[model samples]
Target: MENIAGTKSSLSWAVHISVAALVLIWLFPTVGLFVSSFRTADQIATSGWWKAAFPSEQNLTLRTDPPSTQVQKGGQWVIEGNLFGDKRGATISVYGTSSREISTYKAGETGKFRNGATITVQPNGDYVASSDTKWKGGRGPRVFVTAVTPPEFTLRNYQMVLFDPANREGMARAFFNTLTVTIPATVIPILVAAFAAYALAWMDFPGRALLVAAVVGLLVVPLQLALIPLLSLHNDIGIGKGYLGVWLAHTGFGLPLAIYLLRNYMVGLPRDIIENARVDGATEFQIFTKIILPLSFPALASFAIFQFLWTWNDLLVALVFLIDSTGETTVMTKQIVELLGTRGGNWEILATSAFVSIAVPLMVFFAMQKYLVRGLLAGSVK
Candidate 1:
């Protein structure tokens, strides 16, 4: 009775909970990356992305107006300015004149300098410094302040990561390079595998079973085992290490799964349709182009998503086959690795670059995801 058709299962609630938990587990870091990408370094350092919408306390080292801006006021030289400059709305809680005493004076109190100069800071970040003797030096003294700042977000991270002309490690070039590698790597295998899958699924040929077994066996072959030998072969053939080599490598590695997935899917398509098309004077080429390709879109799209993501995020293959001393052919994965080495402490930049790296794949996945489950499940039922 509990398993009656059209009745809900007793564990449906558990399934729902499990799925929701999985979604949240995957979603949390992605959402964190999206939020952190728009934040400043100081903000990122002080708090997590979950706290981004709330005011945060931060100890900041700032400089007053240069000594050149000092003026003779009454009998003393004076420098007056807002510590935040054009920025506003931060409330200083405590201030200090040196790094060792970062919270020595509460806001709105006057603290005396070594030379009898007095400086006063207000909670609103306004400050006035005065000294009896004329202030010497081209730069003003440093002021460290502990302030509660309102939530702040900026597009400067994205600008620096994607568009800054002077940024040598920017992701723009790597992004386009990844697209260059990914698109061709995805499309070429799909085109080749679609024909092979159609032939395997429908057209009778000698040694077909052995070829299918070989493809199945190839699926279990470790990609790393063949890299050096395949690379040597590429060099021997004059293809060398470049886009062509990497594209072929990705296509070769991707073809087995593509053929397996598409063959299973094409085999499940109505056989009567193909037989009728042949009986109605359609050639095998015509039957395939007109009948098989259109019906196999879901499987094609499913494999596209897989291959695109694999090729896009692939660092080892690109490192072995594509990257050179010029660095012009570098992809996002390699560029991100370089960033980890060079800018490990710059969390905002890392977050922005990581989010940018996943942006295209996310778009592609969401666009074609409906077909993914359908394609995977095509021959499983019948």
Candidate 2:
């Protein structure tokens, strides 16, 4: 009864719940990164991305007008100005004249300074400081305010991360460099593997079984073990440490899985189609080009997504093979690593850079994701 045809499973709701949880787990960080990328440094530092839509309270250290701006008025030296300067609409809840007691006085309350000077701050960040004698300091008094500010979002983080001319650590160059590495790395392997996979799946060869076994075995080989040897071989062949070397490395590493996936998919295609084409005077090449390639698109796209993501996010291979003293060949992963060292505290910049790096991969995945499960399940059924 439980296995009756077309009947619903008892645990279908559980499966749905599990899938929803997984989606949320993956979605939260990506959404957070997207939201954080548009936020200002102060906003990101003080609050989480989940709070981006609402007003936030922050303790800010601001300065009043300097003594130079003070004027003699009503037998006292007075300094009057807005703490936020041109920025408006923030309401200060509590104010303080010293760091130790940052929230000593509520907004609109007057407090006396050390030298008998009285300062009053309004909720709107306007302040008036008056001293009976003369103000002596070159600098203004430091006032700390706990203010509730409206949500702020900005494009300046993207400006600095991508388009700023003076930003030495900008991602524009690294972005193009990653694309240079990833596009060729992905395309070359698919091109080479498609041919090999077609031969293995459709064409009878003397060592076909051995070749398939070899590709399967190569899948288990650790990439780290081959890096130094492959690098040495590349150097010996005079293709050392550049785009060519990295491209070849990625292609070599990617081909086994590509061939395995594509071969499985190509093998499962209706044999009648290939037999009829062959019996009708079509060559193996003709059958492959016309019939097989079109049907194998899902598999090709699946491998493309995997290979594109791997090569795009690759850092160790780039570091080993794309050596450049001037950072001309640096990829986004390497650039982000450099940012961790140089601008570690700038969370907004880091968030913007991280989101920018993943943007293309996300687009690629979503664009071809329908094929992913279809391709992966190709030979498993038949």
Candidate 3:
């Protein structure tokens, strides 16, 4: 008995450890993308996301107030101001008047220049330079400062991707266009599949078995094979490359699986409830609307999540059927692909755009995961 109990405990620990490993593997890239989106372009390029919390030393060429802004105080020429302009706040480790001697003076120490001027810079970027002789020049003296800047983050990437109208490559229109494609594609299929599934599961009809077999057969067919033919058909039918065409394509491609899943799920629902509704003088439409629809929430939600994700993430279907040279109807996934071509070197922009594209699908999955699990479990019951 003790041996069996020990084995069971070991298996439980193994299962937990395996789950932890899988979760980490899945979350690692997403967490990296989320962290990268907040970082400046330089920060993302220089180090990994895990190192973002640590202070980083950077050599920066900064300028003091121009000689034109110098004031005469205490019978001496002076140039006084903060070196790190509105950096929020950063720590200066060392600084120097010449690039060759960038780290010559420690923070809070004074250094004498070749021109008989003394400059003092504090850790917080406040600096003072003074000379008995008047300073001359249109430009400020360049100071090389080695500073340990605090971990920096910015929302400018997301702002540009989402809201900056001036940015021609922004995803605002693409995002809405994706929504336009996804909502109707997701909803239309479920409604059509649910009604078909009800007829297959409950209503008496001929060739029902053959029809279900046909749906099962269609599931094995590759959607890729149909894309070209479907495009030709759409072009001929006056539905060339638009939301309506994409919606119809997604609905047709999705229906086989939808009908298969909903039929199997609805077939498992207790027939007694359906029979009771019939005895209560409920019409078939009323029974489906009031009884079966309420009972089929899990299946509906499951299929909705599936179809939503598929349509949202699909690039091939959208490319083949929807997007045009005008580029007005481009979706988020296409927008990301375009970013890869245009802003390939801009990691901050790429990461931010990718995350924005996936954010909605992730939210929908998390929100309906319970129903998804329920539907899968219920569908599994013979």
Q: Candidate 2 — which residues are off by over 4 angstroms?
A: 1-22, 66-69, 114-116, 132-139, 378-382
Indicate which candidate wins on TM-score.
Answer: 1
Clashes of each: 0, 0, 0
The model with the greater TM-score, 1 or 2, is 1
Q: Model 2 lDDT vs. the true structure?
A: 0.90
Off by over 4 Å in 3: 1-4, 8-19, 72-78, 94-122, 128-142, 275-283, 375-382
Q: Between candidates 2 and 3, which one is better according to lDDT?
A: 2
lDDT of each: 0.91, 0.90, 0.89
User: Please, what are the lDDT tens digits per residue for candidate 2 over residues 322-359?
Assistant: 95787788899998988889889888989999989999
Off by over 4 Å in 1: 1-22, 378-382
lDDT winner, 1 or 3: 1
Per-residue CA lDDT of model 1 for 226-259, tens digit only, reads 7899989999999988999999999999998899
Report the C-alpha lDDT of model 3 over 186-274, residue by residue, as the tens digit: 99999999999999999998999999989888977898999889999999999999989999999999998789889988998998999
Q: Which residue window of length 10 is worst by lDDT in model 2?
A: 373-382
Give residue 70's error in model 3 in angstroms. Answer: 2.7
Which scores greater on TM-score, model 2 or model 3?
2
